[model samples]
Target: MSDAVRKIIHIDMDAFYASVEQRDDPSLRGRPVVVAWRGARSVVCAASYEARKFGVRSAMPAVRAERLCPDAVFVPPDFVRYKAVSRQVREIFLRHTDLVEPLSLDEAYLDATAPKIESPSATATAQAIRAQIREETRLTASAGVAPNKFIAKIASDWNKPDGLFVVKPAQVEAFLTPLPVGKIPGVGKVMQGKLQALGIATVGDLRAHPLEELQARFGSFGAALYRRARGIDERPVQPDQPVQQISAEDTFERDLPLGEFDDAIRRLAEKTWLSTRKTERVGRTVVLKLKTAQFRILTRSHTPETPPASLQEFTEIALALRERVDLPPSTRYRLVGVGLGNFRERDEVVEQAGVFGE
Candidate 1:
């Protein structure tokens, strides 16, 4: 890393899945929309800004989200469609910079230190990207421009849903000072509580602590925190991140017996299946994970000589694995997850099988 500052732009789509639905279906516009499978065991995938005002949020249980906003329209997730739109956005990103790191289908970080498209500044580059996203996709995006990845990510959300913000290199220290410690990446509620116990509520308060003390308190994470408090992140944006594993899990509102897990298993299998389709690689294993009411965790997996050819085969394999569980029939489960792992590129998997397959 050089002392010279880098220009990074973080672009985050606004309520991506829900907004896509609204864009394609005019009636969904201006109406609160929750994108998710409609079931007690289902979770919200994305909520439109209109839905957010009513307290609906992504990953929240669908049952609870319904209670929060009874009038919200619930639509099942369509990852295939979302992934198509995502590819369009990715094309738009590559037009400006090759150094684009896609964090997900809806958000990415672009290293515009030297953009392919000549721009007056990184701020202009971010603005141009946002505008292009709107013009091309008919969806909105928020952008943050800064010297580093962490700051850029945080700034992106400062003014969200079709907004743009910039933090100059000289302004980094002051920009982080008054910010809440929780605003720093990875500082979740548990970490915030730990920091508050030490009277560290803001970045300024955290900065007052000595590095040795912080390291002693938090180990490697604490040392990272010390640097974050000083706005000294040096991490680079990573592009073309390979697929390792894809899974979806849910914690039931109430524990269920193993016999009653069929529906949940099927739903989670579909989610993992849809997610895997977005990647070029093939997942070769089926994994069934269970957490007992007593908090005991168990996992079962099988890697077929060939990857499960269809969702039906994958879901059936997951259900069959449940029969392998040796727990007492009386035992109840609090959580269940379905996954596809042992990811290998399509060509690699095909070559190993001695059969040409997609």
Candidate 2:
């Protein structure tokens, strides 16, 4: 594709999981709702705007959300119901464009440059989609329209909760200039602090630094930052993107010391390995993820010269990865995840493995 203009829209549902709970139960309406299982190890899947007022947020520990909002109703996630609703919303998108890239159950990116429906502009297409979603699902959605994916994603959140924001091609630089570097995707708290330490606070400040200097400081990610600072993103919106990895994770009923997690790791590794069998792609890397009782996350990954050949090999590899955890033995963990990643086509794996006569 050339440097031709593109029409992109990012649609995000308003408090999706919590909103679904409120919509389904009359008692939950107008009340603070936290969507999560009730347990010491449970985490919030979503929080209603009402609950958000009390500082409750998604991914926060359920116990903490309770402390934040004493009266909030806690509901476990019903993925079946959420999937049903998500399908309806996706059907609506299909009517407008086949270039629909779903980000999750409640969000997607639509390329409306050549839409199925005749719209005067991308902004109009976004309004139509949002309206149809509200009419069919009785749920509100926010949208952002821009010349590219990253800008569209950011614009969609500018005026959130049933709002729409637009960033025209001519205005992308101006739109980004005064925005905080943290507002750029992938620039999280740690990255933002590092950038600010260098007196790079806003997007303009990031643009001021030479690319060589940025790469020296932050490596390849710095190159990404350089492009984003200039409001340039060339990634195409890909629909039906392939599965990148397969994994299973669980939170412990009680926090357990590192040595006590071997059984958990074996079970999760078996589960993950079985999932990978369903795909033709082979996974070469085994990842072990641990979440401390205090909520810090740590992961250890190893890519062997060849993919694990059987369930036994996969399990042993996952078990051995546990030794890489340098946390104090007394440091209990609340969660464990086993994953197979770095997936490659079977033919490619075989071709690479042939080089070592394996």
Candidate 3:
């Protein structure tokens, strides 16, 4: 909101998951690689730049990616090792500024307007972080430095793998006007279609529309779109914000029978627990999600005062939720998912409970 500009930097790892695989395996270096098991039901976690050249990408089914890149080497995902590397990278970031907000394991925003060290500018801070990642992790990171989060985030992707781009306060409009609407965050396939239908296909096009008209179409999100299109984002770099929940879900390739539900829920609960453990947080609720063969979704949740802290307790809650479902034996389902919620720091649980009379 102020005319005085701030220095924000977004650092994104270069094809992070696939890069990890290539970094570890001598044979995978400089090769087209896909990180996924070979199966029709399997989804790609990441694809190397070489693999991406053949139109492979994350979340695309491995079966389709294989058809796209016939010679691509498939490697199983090892999230455990990936997280380890991510932690190392985080430490590197902390050495510069505590205003680091991790978007995921692979990307983060750093507010270095006034960093711990007297860096001349945000660009220098970004260069240091990128260089540290390369030296310590043997991987590359792309960085964008700008006056705000929205501009910086978009600039980070402009140059591609292992590149850096900058967006100065004076040049924000020039950098954003020619970009497509989809390049703005939150403008996915459906939103893009909506904008396209309104004859607003580019950032400049959106800017031409009246704020009132945009608001009528998109509610509060319209205002956000207007700001982002103009390369303005006031969101703070929230590194200290506590995580509220952790969840994992799956969309089944085909509907599964009720008899098969128990095993599926068990597996999902285990997966959720494993993921939550990585963040070192405990949850008070267990959630089970089900989707019918016809795409009807149902969710069941339980908040036990004493949340399950072990695999045995995890399985117990999941089985209990499964029993509550009234689907017939022949009824089929398309998806099953499990999750944990109402999380808090382990050390603060006692105080949290007392405040809530738990």
Candidate 4:
């Protein structure tokens, strides 16, 4: 609404895991590589550009990736090392501005409207940060600089691998109009299909729809879509944001019988609990996801007034979710996932201590 422009930059590391593997091992240089174990259960964590030529992609099964590229090299993932490298890259970002939000280990958003320099231009900050990442971490990062997060995130991917793109404030609408609605964040497969069914094919088409009509059809998310279509996102870049969710999942080599599903759920719950050590916040909901042998997915979730305080409590909540699923006994499962959600601010909880004490 305010015509003021905010400089935002998005940076994504190039084939992060695979590149790190190659950077550490000269023997793997310039080769088609998939960072994952060779098994039906394992998914590709990252694929080198060479592997992408063969259609290998992250989250794709390693077996399928191998089928796509017979000579593709499979490497086990080392998330510990990846996280360490990510910290180093983040330190590089901190040197530029404090308004840094990490999307994942290899990607982040930076607000450079007020940089610690004589000139606080977004493009200059992006270039300097990228140069620093390459010089310090030996990794190349593609960067997109724009007036807002919506444009910056898309611009970052415009140039793949080691590239830099910028979308000036004046160019926002022209840049967004021709792009498909599917390109907007949160518009996934089902949402895109819905938009297509309504003759809203492009961002321009979405812009043409009455905001009230969109709200009538899709609720609050439709309002977000309207903003994205207009290249208007007002979310500020956040620094050191607290964790919102914790989850753990496992893909089975073969469809496991319902008899063994309980064990898998227990393991995942334990893993999820272990992963929560980094977060001070507690979750008020538990969710269980199951993917059948046919890949038909089902999710069951529950939210309690109080969060689970221990691993045993969390496991029990997960078991309750398992009881809610009424799949056929003969139906086998390919994956099982456990998650906790609906986090509350730790500080808010701390502040409520006196009230609860009363």
After TM-score superposition, what is the CA distance of residue 274 in candidate 4 from its true location, in Å?
Answer: 14
Error of 4 at 71 (Å): 0.7
**Candidate 4 — what's its lDDT?**
0.84
TM-score of candidate 3 relative to the true fold: 0.76
For candidate 4, write residues 46-140 as lDDT tens digits: 89999999999986767799999999888877767887898899899988888899877888999888887655478888989889999998989
Q: For residue 113, what is the lDDT in candidate 2?
A: 92
lDDT of each: 0.89, 0.88, 0.83, 0.84
Q: Which is the winner by TM-score between candidate 2 and candidate 3? A: 3
Candidate 2 backbone clash number: 0
Looking at model 4, the pairs that clash are: none
lDDT of 3 by residue, 161-236 (tens): 8999998998989888989999987787667888999999999999998878889989999998888877767787
Please give, for residues 314-352, the per-residue lDDT of candidate 1 as tens digits: 999999999899999999999999999999988888798
Best by TM-score: 1
Q: Where does model 2 exceed 4 Å of error?
A: 246-286, 289-320, 324-358
> Which residue ranges in model 3 land beyond 4 Å of their true spot?
1-4, 246-340, 344-358
